[model samples]
Target chain A: MELQFKSELTISESGFLFDHSTGLTYTLNSTGQFIFRKIQDKQNAMHILNFVMQEFDVSEETAHKDLDDFVRQLKEFDLVSR
Target chain B: MTEKKAYSKPTIIRHSVGVQNKFGRPPATVPINRLDGFEVSELAEKYGSPLFVLSVKALRDRYRDLKRAFSTRYPNFQIAYSYKTNYLKSVCSILKQEGAWAEVVSGFEYDIARNIEVPGNQIVFNGPYKSHEELTRAFNDGAIVNLDNYDEMQVVEKVASELGKTLEVGIRINMDLNDPPWHKFGFNVEAGHAFEAVKRAEAGGKLKVVGLHIHTGTYVDDVTIYSRAAQGLVNFYSYIQEQLGVKLKYWDLGGGYASHNTLHGAYLPAEQTCPTFDQYAEAICPILMSGPFQAQDAPKLFIEPGRAIIDEPFSLITSVVSQKRLPSGQRGVLLDSGMNIMSSVQWYRYNFQSAQDSGTMLEDTIVYGGLCMNIDVLQASSSIPPVRRGDLLVIPHVGAYNISQSWQFIYLRPAIIAIEDGEVYVIKKAETRDYVQGFEDVPGKFITN
Candidate 1:
């Protein structure tokens, strides 16, 4: 499955994400920013895990656990659609 | 190697028209995470969630400030702690320790004061519903029970005659203060009923009207209202002295002082609009000190300031239970508390802040209490930071009636913690299933089901 971000959103270099549709703003941490950029590029769940395991010094299991929870939270926030 | 990132919930907020932009200045969004140096999370974790954190220092300082404000201005002034505002044993004990006379409204509140052994003469009893037994006991104990209506006056007279004791009491006089008259409590002074009642009671020869009490309204913010109410009572004081030859001992200006909580739909926050203690003292003290009452003969001033003195000393500590997006695109946050816990939120827009740093996004969020009913809302469109689940929240200005008015409905009531001498003491234990059901009896016939 692919994760796609809505087009009405903007992500800044400093991890500030603003939704133009809702006129709302949010801050993303490093992990959240990593996932948001990957999902914007239409990365699948496995590609996201592989990226966190390399960028952050985390084992494959920690990356798998955190990225799954992060993506599910993003889905809950309606920032991304599956 | 990279460090693990501190994660907050993935959050989205919509800039609605009426949510954040409100009331010129934004609502009080002061970041308050602790009460008297004790972190909110520590109190919640140790005692329970939805707890009431009361500062003993705040209570003493408020009472002393009010006492100084009035006592320094007027020659004689006495404060009676109105028990109905908050009758927790610990609160009452602190007030009594602070040199406050107990003002109870019911037989139950009177007993609470007495159980703490507040002097009977120091206790002022005022309410509409008083039984014959309660009045007899009040008079016997020399408690200054104010007569509310004719029935209560008759009860006092009957009991005084039967026990062969001359009763010295006060009468709560209701009159117009340019607002609609409150006529249900006592005899109407405007309609001459107060004059007639005093004469009749004096003629009965058993009840001596020692004082006159006037409680015009609640949340009384106007100094003019207080001035008018005091003037009206003073006029009656002169009338009673002129016609019946009785020198009134005191004037119980009943409590209605407003606190710093903003009222719903008010243009100004109560901190700005509500009259200060000094203003209230200046307005009413001049009236009592100048005319008719001599410098030495100024009838002692007795005040029952409930909310103004108590509202600031305590706060309700609750936790965010869940978050929901309302259909109207507003953020809906549910707290483990609601009207059941913070009952004053029904009228006042209390200040709520996240116990921990939730987020910087200051948005208008609707807070709901942990109840199934719709009226269980704590704040309607309060400007608060994005609160994450399990993060504790502190809501202030709840010291007045929240505890006294709190009920056990969907969930049992929460614990009450009073910060005394820099230590947390649970003055009231959190209600358990058995404590809530202790008085509930299951009939034997219905138990089979």
Candidate 2:
């Protein structure tokens, strides 16, 4: 599925994310920032998983779990939509 | 070439309005690696996970410390280890070796004491329901039998008449102590029921009333209730002596002392709330010492301590089965242990410690047992260090009711090991399918094997 984030959502390099529609603020860890940056660049879940697995010394299962959990939280907060 | 950075789970913290102390400083995680100088992991490996590890040193020390606290203060004091708390034969044997007499409340427990060769004279049999056969056995064996009601008195009188011997008995009395009273087991002293029972027993002529017993409620954090119980029992003792002219030789202040395990709703840990053995002794001994009887004719002050003596010596070792994040944004971890084996979790917030020193990224976690039932939660709210699947967790202060009340529900009960002088001894073997189904009888038609 195409990973789509809110059009007006603002993100910073230091892992600060703010959604204009909900006015909710979030702080992400470095790994989470990398995934969100990929999502903001309109990357798909598969590409993001591959990027995380390649960038960090993580197994495919760990990278997949992290990507899924991050995406779930993003969807839970209405920051991302399919 | 540069190495790739280590991977940690990607995490996000949402900052919402009115959220105070969001992600507050994680509580320090002090892992419990060794118990009695034996590695918990090694013991778990040897005995299997979800095991019960008991410390013989702790058991003997707790019993001795409690006995010393009372005997040093009051010269005529005696301790009878209550059996219903943890009726493991090995546990009872240890206390027996420590010079404690057996205090049983049921026919089964009485049988256990007998099977352990605890002489009837050394057994203080106290409870409401004692069958005629049990009473006869106790009386014939010269056990200190405390009659609970008029019905029991009549039965005892009949037993004494049949034996053609006048049997000495103690009447269990209960008073309104303003702290949740245990009026179920004994005759009510406030309502004059105890006096009436004593008078009836005396007039019967077959039973001689020689003792008065009272048991306050269990896990009594307040020490003053003991003081009140002592004073009330003493007053009743004097009244019985003066009015009925019956001299009492025993005054049993039954066990309800709190252990180091925290109660469910307490704000502070039990170590801070529970009264010390010295405090309990101070609350009780002074009054009994200055009672209506002199030193030479002083009534034997008997205490039946089960929880305080047994609770701190045992620890439960469980392994994490799986982890999940619940809908409420809380961590949920499942363990091989459950309410079936650790039933005392209903009344206590038992401390769970990491068996290994995992990093200190403490998370708010809820621990569930392996049971399919929803009520199998071990800890409703806990702050624990990050533990992966198969990581060992040790729960201390579970030696009291966990074993005696443990049920062989869905999972077979685990083994119990006693660490004595740095050596491991298996007290109870893990329940196998054969052991669980040993007593079952299936119809031939229903069994298609």
Candidate 3:
């Protein structure tokens, strides 16, 4: 799976995301921002979960659990593609 | 290391330029997670999605507040609970326990009043569609029927003659107060229909005209309309008394009290625009007290308070079923409830809130009900935080017409529970598919097909 959006999209340092294709805007939380950047940097699901596990002091099992739910949500919101 | 962070669904919302930003109004993201110490999420889980949760506290408080607002100002007054607005047995029982007369508008509602054991004398039947049998029962049982038309006046007389008793009844009066006269339901006060109707009742001898009733319209926001409507009724009251030499026993300013629910396409929230109980009281009490009735002969001021007493108490808790992306790239969440059960959604832009906060990022969202119809949209457009399937949403101010008018269409209506001080009372059990189909019969031809 990979994070996908139109090439004209813009993500500010403060986590303000703009979908240039649809002209919609969104603000991401700290975790959302980190995940989005990692996705944009072509990180896989395991890599993203590892990063979350390391930074958020969560067990690998919890990180994997949350990452699956979070990615499913990203797919629902059209922020990523399977 | 720091603690693990919470999760919020990834969301995108269309940012539009509007005058709303210039007004600096309060943001619409109000979190209503718990009610009467019960978590809304748990309520949906326990009672299935699309649950209607009514608050016994809010109902009692509103009844107390409205009664206090009027009774403290005037001596002769009664708050009749309008049965058509919300005739949930427990809802009506609460008001009746608080000393309210049941004001019904149909034979069905009249029967409901009777089934609840409210005495015929304590019921005020006020509708245009009373059947002959219903009229006979009302006349025989001594229920006050507000005569809606001249034909109804004849029906009352016939019933009274059959019962061999002179029946006391109220005449339904309608007048133009800048708004269109609802001409179909009652005798027009301006066109002398009301006056002539009274004379006929007087000459007919079997009917005793006892009250002047006027229900101008519903969701009446302007407080002055009550004064204007009351003044019209009072003038007509004086005219009837002077010409026919009969004094009215009551002056019923019928129901249509506006609650704080913002209408769709409305510029301001209804709380800011809707008149308060005090405002309505201030407008009409002085006039009713000073109206043509002599100080010694003042009639009991009757108001069928329905929406005003019931609307604030209930909240509909529906769960998000699925999320679909709209053409505008906004999330359209389909909830487990829709316009079929939530008829008020077809009229007002109901306040929908997340059961719990997800993020500070408010997005444009469209809320739809679980119905398979195209017209089942709840809130066509609103700003709200992220929500996903199986999450909870709460819609408030639905205790009025929504329940009474709801019919089982495609889906069965949900359970309705009344909460009081952390206690739950099941006012209505959730409808089931078997229950919906139980009354239906398959014709022979249809069964063969």
How accurate locally is residue B422 in candidate 3, as Cα lDDT from 0 to 100?
75
| Candidate 2 positional error at B101, Å | 0.8
Q: Which is the winner by lDDT between candidate 1 and candidate 2?
A: 2
Candidate 3 per-residue lDDT, tens place, B1-449, comes to: 56666545444343466656443436667788998899888887788878899889988999999999999888888999999889999998888899999998888999899988999988898888898899888877778789898887887788877888888888888898745656766788788888888888889889888888888788888888889997887788878878898788898999888998877777888868888899999999888876775666689889988888888899989888877665555567888887888888866888778898766667677888888898888888877777766778888889988998898888888899999877898889999888888988888997784
The candidates' interface RMSDs, in order, read: 5.5, 2.0, 4.8
Each predicted model: what fraction of the native A–B Cα contacts (within 8 Å) does it retain?
A: 0.16, 0.70, 0.19
Candidate structures ordered by lDDT, highest first = 2, 1, 3
Off by over 4 Å in 3: A1-13, A16-26, A35-82, B1-4, B12-14, B21-25, B28-30, B442-449
Give the Cα lDDT of each candidate.
0.81, 0.86, 0.81
Top candidate on lDDT is 2
Those runs of model 1 whose alpha carbons end farther than 4 Å from true positions after fitting are: A1-82, B4-6, B10-30, B440-449
What is the per-residue lDDT of model 3 for residues A1-82, given as tens digits with 9 covering 90 to 100? 5555434568899878888777767667677778788888888887777777666655665456546655665665566786
- Where does the lowest 10-residue lDDT sum fall in candidate 1 chain A? A61-70
lDDT of 2 by residue, A1-82 (tens): 7799865878788878888887778877787788888888999999988888878998997678657766776776667898
The DockQ value obtained for model 1 is 0.20
Cα miss at B287, model 1 (Å)? 1.5
Question: Which whole-number lDDT from 0 to 100 does residue B141 have in model 3?
Answer: 77
